[model samples]
Target: MSKGLKGKLVLAISSRALFDLSESHQVYLTQGIEAYRQYQIEHEDEVLEPGEAFPLVKKLLSFNASLGRDRVEVVLVSRNSADTGLRVFNSIQHYELAISRAAFSGGRNPHPYLNAFGCDLFLSTHADDVRSALDAGFAAATILAGGTRRAQSNELRIAFDGDAVLFSDEAERVYQAGGIEAFQVLERESARSPLRGGPFKGFLEALNLLQREFPDDACPIRTALVTARSAPAHERVIRTLRDWDIRLDESLFLGGLDKSAFLEAFAADVFFDDQAGHCERARQVVATGHVPHGISNPLRDLPAD
Candidate 1:
């Protein structure tokens, strides 16, 4: 294990998540691994287009330039074998992204290497990999094929769902079993008590630490909490953030309203939610990551939305 990456914010992203490899992936799906390997070799010189997470990765890497040190690292974790992964490296080089580390598992599960890389976050198009990473206590999301609307401002705006993504799904469990009435009652009763941190808590804390490096007025990174909770239920979330000493640039308690327009209004680069329905709607306006976590995601073997 390399102790040098201890203090840095590290991200492990899949090749499919980092670059647009849908065409090549289709080759693999229709044909077999041998055909896919040949296709990649034939197109080794061609550059792969950016995927949903590419812009976010660029913004993340930009922090190093502002801080004048390698404070953030993005490592490529893919199922493609090294021989077939040459195109991915070529694409990274073409984009001039400062990502040199990689773990090509040759179609095996690569979540185990995330711990070795000391990854705080993991993004992948593969749902199973994301679920495995989350199961291993790392913040992970399945990157969806979302809209192409990138934030116009230089600021990198990231949005997250409250319940499974940031806080534990305890209240969500109530909502799932009982109804919204029961969930609201639970929130009102536990208003003062802070909610437990979820898988993304550590990732959020790391972002906060990075945000502190710059002046608050001029920080390039902005985060928002976009949830369905409203009014009385929101009290617990506020108190939980206070308890954790974490701050968000914006908070939206939509009260079960559609989140697509609000996310577009916020000009978010990416939004994360645990619900497939929310992810399906939000992705229409902004890049979305489906977080398969908490009680909501009981079917682990289901495909990504």
Candidate 2:
């Protein structure tokens, strides 16, 4: 018989995203892979400090305690070969994380395996991997390392941006090519039509399913739509979510106000946005991931120089 990942709420994470492997990553950058492998082997027993995505991962796994083990699974999927990954396993053991499965993809990009693993989300610090994962049609984000580490709260709070994130970049492309007024006008006109879902739609649907596991308002997870859209423009967002049959606990229309303060007030465990600028500020207040999608990711137009 063969094992499969078909029905579980899967999170395929990179080793670096699960633990603090910065020192070893530096060695790989400056010294080389051999030196990095040797270093990880030597430090096999050292408990790693939590990385940016640690709290979120831990909390996601916590859902299993109530939802049953079959409901959630976290796979340690990364480019690290088995030889250099012992330290990561050791750290997982030391911290007592519930993750057990792994796929050591060596030098190859692991994004392809997201579907193989039925991954609802794929998070890594590697921008290339993230981009590849998104391109491959998985809900993916680049974990921003060295952010203010968020302590695991009793309730899981996830925040997401509107354009290029929860909703498609259709209106955002208009905003980027035209201007704020143009964007607002188009959004207002399309208010009744309901914007299309973005890349995280499946991930959010998975989360919504998890929220349903609990009866009534007792679900431990709460979500927020913290976006820059304001006024009549906000109508499309609301209609879009309704059209998708998705419900968010809170929606903050900042109209381009800095989102850090609002996210802080919401106490988000993790925040996702397509822009590096929003993630920079969000990470300062909470754990943040850069969803490198839509028109914002310029590498699509201009090759890496």
Candidate 3:
């Protein structure tokens, strides 16, 4: 929504981020929401403690906003029970920080259900849930296996594409489907038109909160936009970011050139793009993510590694 959240670091933590569950405790989660529902019904008045997951959530949240105020948003999602959401929210509030959003599937199958929340990143128990969320639109991961390690730093350097990452993919979709000729015509016609909100808008707002908290003249979290559009087509991108009052540390409009070099020089920790070619190339330089265009890719249908 803010043109792009290129340089911002977004860390998504789940209820599981606060505590660890034993093998027995994990049985209900594995069984899905039905098992959780039964457990809650049996022990209506029982209150669950914030397991080992709570401290990690606090650590990540604190690291994100360490330089200033309200820089991080902890979105609490639960499928354990209705009461589980309240319990997690209360724990977060105990630290004087509120949960950004809450989502519950009421089913033990957390993967399919949590996918609907549109989290930028997901911290949860299921490894498959992390993969699904990443495949959707968010950079998701499980809390275990070093998922939160890379995100521990406050000074995160992130890269994003302009058209789809920040603004709506409507125009880019037209371009990709119709070709350069049609794209130019559309851009010329829509010179005065504004773009719509993107998947990263809410994530950008969260970063803005971080920026406001620090308010340093220099940007602590560096961001860059490596886009294919140039000159005139770039006006909308600039205007949109300015209008939203979002600040980008760096921006490059490379018309038709490859972006791998710029990304390498920037030393970006992660780069996201809808084009597999771009992500493939950027991966050689940084930890890259291929954002599925919500369109089919005939080439990548092979079984997962």
For each of the candidates, give the backbone clash count. Answer: 0, 0, 14
How far in Å is the alpha carbon of 147 misplaced in model 2?
A: 2.6
Q: For candidate 3, write residues 1-305 as lDDT tens digits.
A: 22122334445555664544343255564886566555545543444455434543454466554555444555566555566455555555666654566656554545553334434455565545544664555644333321122334446576778676567787788887998888888877777677775655555666655556555765456778888888778877777788787877788999979988887767665666656666656666665545443332333532121
Residue-by-residue lDDT tens digits, candidate 2, 239-263: 8888889878899999889999999
Quote model 3's TM-score.
Answer: 0.59
The local distance difference test score of model 2 is: 0.85
> Total clashes, candidate 3?
14
Off by over 4 Å in 3: 1-10, 13-65, 68-120, 123-154, 295-305
What is candidate 3's local distance difference test score?
0.58
lDDT, model 3, position 303: 17
The RMSD (Cα, Å) of candidate 2 is: 2.6
TM-score of 1: 0.97
lDDT of each: 0.91, 0.85, 0.58
Residue 154 miss distance in model 3 (angstroms): 6.3
